[model samples]
Target: MGKTTGTRRGAWAAIRRLAASDRAAGLIMLGFALIGLVAANLPLTYHLFETIAETHIGIPYTNIDLPIGHWAQDGLLTIFFLTVGLELKQELTTGSLSNPKAAAVPMLCAVGGMLAPPILFMLVIALFSRFGPGEMGSLILTTTGSSIPFGEMAHGWAVPTATDIAFSLAVLALFARGLPGSIRAFLMTLATVDDLLAIILIAVFFSSVNAWYWFIGIAVCAGVWAYLVQLKRVPWAVVAVVGVLAWVMMFEAGIHPTLAGVLVGLSTPAREIHGETTPRAERYASKLQPFSALLALPIFALFATGVHFEELTPALMLSPLVIALIVALVVGKPLGIITTAWLSTHLGGLKMAKGLRVRDMIPTACACGIGFTVSFLIASLAYTNAELSAEARFGVLVGSLISALVSGILLSWQSKRFADATTDATR
Candidate 1:
């Protein structure tokens, strides 16, 4: 019994370490994205890359039929989203979001971050429509010569609205290491709300279920999940099985299956149970965040970030769709984050997190624009045409690059300033 308990402790320790190394995941994602970019452009490797991304993987007995890329997107990505849901649940129950006064600023900032990007996207499209020739039509809006309708392109607006929490947190871990703990909490809360909003957008706007019964089935599953989580001692394995079943049902219902992650994660108890020492949210995160950060995200990046440079000409690069995404991500994200956060603190009477000023927010807010994983997903969902998808992917890559660079410089500068001030005060 002693030996068994020691082994269990060792395993949990390893899992905790893995869960903590999100910075490593970010670095690995960056390296793989660079490799994907290189492989996509190299003629010798391009065929292999496409094959790997497009290969079909399914259980024929169960009638599961999707490309390997789709599996990574729809199935494995749920693990990552589940971790996200766990974090959100923890915050809402016991962390930064538990306090209404403290939560107000970041929550408002998240709302701003979501609201500003799409409006800018539409406004930019409108500007192009007004001034440019009919050839430069917006991706979602109807232009003089466009074949795509307004409804389709409108879906793409949510692409920039999402803040890739993985990448954003990675940046915070890397450059803002010296900042106050509350700043990290603030950003996490903001990103959580941002993700919650994105998930809602996917459900309301993107769902295309064929029958009402499918939703009824999902609702029943969710009700059971909620009820089970409230119990003192419940079978987690059974919950896992039910979660998978619900995912399949959601997929069949034409809703994005990853919402399964959100549902399960949210249903988990963030507080400690009667018999357990650890909270369910933390327990679930320790077991799952490692798989999510180390495997799921990297694989998704490998499949999604491979953009062939040869296919992108000057015309395609400068197309209204591409340009609009770039501008929205790089400009609109920071603008929305800052504007709304400022309003919350100054006008709405919410206090800023300790040791953080409005000045400190600029760099972090800019980092919020790194809408990598979900942005690419939304882009694909928004446009079925390969050309449009490729262009949007390229735009996301460029915009994230720009956001990373600018935020990196600014964060480094801010850190230096804070350090120097501390030194002076000590003297």
Candidate 2:
């Protein structure tokens, strides 16, 4: 019994260590994504994987019924968003974002990053319409042999605008050794703001309200949560129950349920309360980060990346939509970020963090091109046609992979330069 208990303890310790590692989390999610892709393409396993993903399991008589895939995307993914919210709150209250002067550059850069992708997407569509497979003014044909109108195709403009905070941060942690800490801070601020913008886009464009009155329940739950967290001894169980109720309300209200996680996270107090030394937001983020990193994100990646590559043809691969998405993420993201940062610092009178220059931001800009998580979510929400959606997702996957590889290489090079400079200084 003693030996067994010790082994169990050891296993638990190892699991915790893995969960806490950003590199491990990123690698695990990537591995699972590859597994999902392979599983989706293999004839023998495709049907099984599809069945598992499509199967629904939810409480009866509730509006919570969703397929396993959606449960990962909308349900389990909320935990990760909640952690993001907590981190955002901390940054706003006390971290990098607290100072308006310091925050301006990243905020503007985030706006630039968001704006460029959609413009590029529209430009690509215009080019395709004017030049490819149709008359100068006619609809462009898609890989699925459908000619969608320009307006319909434009719905996917937001798909490549997102930057996956988890993946971008993971790459930075893994490859950015010996670089300035300010770079990480800048990346975190930029990614957080990027996510905030994506959340707004999801709420504004993607939501289809069925019952507006359900927001009353959400408000009440949020109120209760705010109240509970302020108590001397917070009732964590009650807080969790209230949070679930808020999510249900949000879902029933026709808003995306994941927003509830952000709502609750923002509601959590960032200041120390009840004589606690550490703030509740920081503690909550620390506790939840492991779960978000280990399970929620990997599961979401598994379903989100299960694109059937076997179905893609060479012509489809070269489709205007695919080309646009890839270009928007890979080229537009970095271009917008670097340009905005440079303009903000040089022209707009905003200063970057000390010892940081526009040139130092190149790798960070490339890292911002990793539009995986929220990008995948937006792709599904952007298109009702299954084939179009799959193609859009494929574009996101390829674009994000290219961004990751490029950013990793750049970060390593930058780290080596920094190391060499330090060695020379020591001499």
The global C-alpha lDDT for each of the candidates, from Candidate 1 onward, is 0.80, 0.88
How well is each residue in 21-135 modelled by candidate 1, as lDDT tens digits? 7577777777777787778778899888888878998865676789887898899889988888888898888887788787888888888988888888877666765554335
Regions of candidate 1 where Cα sits further than 4 Å from its true position: 1-19, 61-63, 131-154, 227-237, 307-316
Candidate 1: worst-modelled 10 consecutive residues by lDDT: 137-146
Question: Per the 3 Å backbone cut-off, how many clashing residue pairs does candidate 2 have?
Answer: 0
Task: Indicate the TM-score of model 1.
Answer: 0.89
lDDT of 2 at 192: 83
Q: For candidate 2, write residues 1-427 as lDDT tens digits.
A: 9999999999877887887776888888888887887788889988999999999999778857899998999899999989988988998899878886878999899999999988898899888877545556568788766787777778899999999887898899899999998999899889888988898999999999886678788888989998998898888899989999988888888888999999999999999987899999998998887788888988888898886654646676687788899899988999999999988888998998898889999998998988988998899889997767888888898888999999999999999999999999999
In model 2, the Cα lDDT at residue 16 comes to 74
- Candidate 2 achieves a global lDDT of 0.88
Please tell me which predicted candidate would have the highest TM-score against the true structure. Answer: 2
Residue 423 of model 1 has an lDDT of 87
